[model samples]
Target chain A: MRLLLTSATSEFGRTVADLLSGDHEMVLTDQTRHAEGHPDVVACDLGDDDSTDRLVAGIDAIVHIGHGGHFSSASDLLDVNTRCTYNLLTAVRNAGINRVVNLSTLRLLDDYPEHLTVTENWRPTPGVEPVILSAHLNEYVCREFGREGGIKIANLRLGFPLVAGNTAAAAASGESAALAGDDLLTAINAALTADLGVNAQSTDAPHPVSFRTVHVQSPFENGRFLLKGAASILGLWEGQGVA
Target chain B: MKILILGGNGMLGPWVVDALGDRHQLRITDIGEPPETTHEWRQIDVSSLDDVVDAAEGMDAIINLSVLRPHRKIAFDVNTRGNYNMMVAAVTHNIQRVINTGPHYQLAGPSYEDWDFDLNPDMPPQPGTRLYAHTKALGQEIDRVFTTKHDVYLQTLLFYHLYDPGDIGNGPGGSGVESLGKDMMTPYSIAWPDAGEAIRCAVELPLERLPSRAETYMVFADVPHSKFNNSKARGQLGWQPRYHLESLWNKR
Candidate 1:
């Protein structure tokens, strides 16, 4: 599938770009012109609907990095996540793009006690920090579009402090939760392709909206965060992660 | 109580001021200078974090009536970021209460209003298409997050149509229209003073009296239109509307 990877210059964006590059056709876009730019990257501020529309044309899917996605002010962070996501999804609907994978963080649920197993259905307690708050705002905008039945979004609230390799994973091992490179890729790839109707054969299935929030994390040995929501809604198996 | 009112110069600002002014001290802030009033006013932009934090200093609570309806950029700036800033300030200052206001459509946009009746505000906000509704909904969601995390009591008063007592109900040949999608959306109706009273109720209600840290109340009067309900406001906040908006729905 031809994918449009937004905020293409961020570390998270670059990681996803590197991971997904082998299989899919990637069209990278940054909100602003980057000094160190990628060959596949096209700079476009998503707040401008016309430019965003032009950028999204001919794309099969989008990997929207919901957080650490913008290279702008904290105020613009709110716009890029909420209004720009709204603008981009509006464009996606206009362009008839059916599927989108929005990268979010499991830290939004960090407020929950460690002993209690957390799932996607639980209300995210993404308290007042701007980046987390902004990403939370992104889910709100994307879900509304899904409720409108215009676009289908797979919102992945992945684990905290996304690590690069085995060594870095080892370095950050003691942390509450962490997502390694391969697990992140597997979740995104699954989200991009999984049928939202995998279980719901009947027309009146209880799918509230075209959107599904799945918790994705590289749950290493006896990890507390559950991947059941991802497995059921997105078909991403627990075994497939980097455990 | 010494309350800081952000975007306190908008349409609902004066009404809120009128309702709470005599009872509590107010430090109101808006992007532009407020209308000639004796209330303490400051030229503050809610979108600016510094501006909001500065104005929130030494305040017991905050009332965010700041809203921008047009221009996508400014709309998001004031409606969404403004709320984020307010929540951050509320947490920073340890202010215990916030009275947030927005249109009813922010929760029940065209999708809810067009499809369902007896609509209540508690329904998970489905603010589908309208820009104003969408932005304000995002703001309200931010407030919910803050209330969940902190000790702040978030009383969001959702309004739709603001009517005056003396003004004539102008509908199709003076017949009541349940809702007006005619020029723009006025999905529910409440007198400005009644809306103010609802804010006052929220402002003064004992924190223990609130069911939760975060509660949303639809603030319109009991009009004949069966579109939206304010049972939550009445039952929860003990809000009572003085004007029933009889001309708009009842036979004159």
Candidate 2:
């Protein structure tokens, strides 16, 4: 499938590009003009409507790095996540690209205690930290677009400090919420191909719409966040961690 | 108490100034020049965090009336990032109270407006992709995050159509949408002065008296259609509409 990946120089950008490059037709873009040794990434400011529309044409799906990282300041975070995202989504829907896999983080729920079974149904009490709060804001924009029935958004909230190895290594790194790279790839693949509906992932919303949130984490047992939404909506299984 | 009013030269700003001008000390800020007022005014842009932070210093509370509907770039700047700057500045200065104003669609857009009635503000905001509603909703969401995380109180008063009591049918371009002859007006509509009064009510209400750290009030009057419910605002803020918009529902 043809895909457009945004923030191609941000955190985990190179890793995602390298991993997904062989499998699919990739068009990568970043706000910055140049990345060392990789010249194919088209420089397109996601905030600019003309640039985004030009970039979005002929794209089948999008993988948006929704977590607001790799920026200059708090203003950059606010603009990129809220304004640039709004522009990007508006351009996408206008261009008839209906599918988006917004990459968010599970840290928005880190405030909850260890014992509680935190799932996608539970609302994220996002702290004032710009990155986390901006991520929550990204989900809001995606949900509204999905709710409008113009797009089908699968907001995959991945575990933090996404590591590129087995779960054993990730656990050894001491970040309890670490997600293995393979699990991350699999979740994105599922989101890209899933039959998303208004009520696909969310069970608690009285009137669920197209935007779905799935908590994707590794070591599928006794993790900080439960995977009810990912299991049902993204067709994720425990074996996929090792598969 | 001393209050900082952002976008204090806009349409709703004067009404808010009218409501609170005599009672509380107000410091007004806007990108444009202000109306003739004895209170202090500053030419500030809300999208700039530095500008907002500087404007918000030493104030007891901040009231944001900034809104830009038509232009996309300026709209997002003023509407989306403006809220971000407000919250950050509020926390920076340790200001505890803030009152924000936006259209009702910011919380309940066409997703609710098209199909539902008795629409309250507590429902999850589903503001579909209309520019004004979408932009303003993002601001509200930003404000919600700051309220949850910081040592601050947020009160948002949402209004729909704004009408003048004397010029009910006589706004720009002759007979307006708020006329007496209208059979079915938007149930979320409120008069301009009443909208301002809602701000005063939000400001005066004690923080301890608030039911929650963050509260949103659907700032409409007692209309007949009952399409939107103002019970929360009425019960909590004790705000009653001084203008009788009987001509809207009762066409006598």
For all candidates in order, the CA lDDT equals 0.81, 0.83
Task: List, residue by residue over A1-243, the lDDT tens digit for candidate 1.
Answer: 999998888877888899999989999998666614566679787874589899999999999999866556678778789888888888899999999999988878888898787777688888777788888889889888877886788888888777776424723676556777877887888888876643255566645347888887765655658778877776766464333
Docking class of 1: medium
Q: What share of the true interface contacts does each candidate keep?
A: 0.84, 0.76
lDDT of 1 by residue, B168-214 (tens): 45422334444333323334777888888999999999888877898
- Candidate 2 residues lying further than 4 Å off, grouped into runs, are A33-38, A197-209, A238-243, B169-178, B181-184
lDDT of 2 by residue, B1-252 (tens): 899999999988999999999999999999997779999999999989999999999999999999999888888899999999999899999999999989888888887877888899799887887889989998998898888777799999998777876666432333433466564454766778888888999999999998777899998878777678899998899999866566666654
- Which residues of candidate 1, in runs, are more than 4 Å off? A33-40, A70-73, A161-177, A198-209, A219-221, A238-243, B169-187
Clashes of 2: 1
Instruction: Report clashes for each candidate as comma-separated counts.
Output: 0, 1
Q: What is candidate 2's local distance difference test score?
A: 0.83
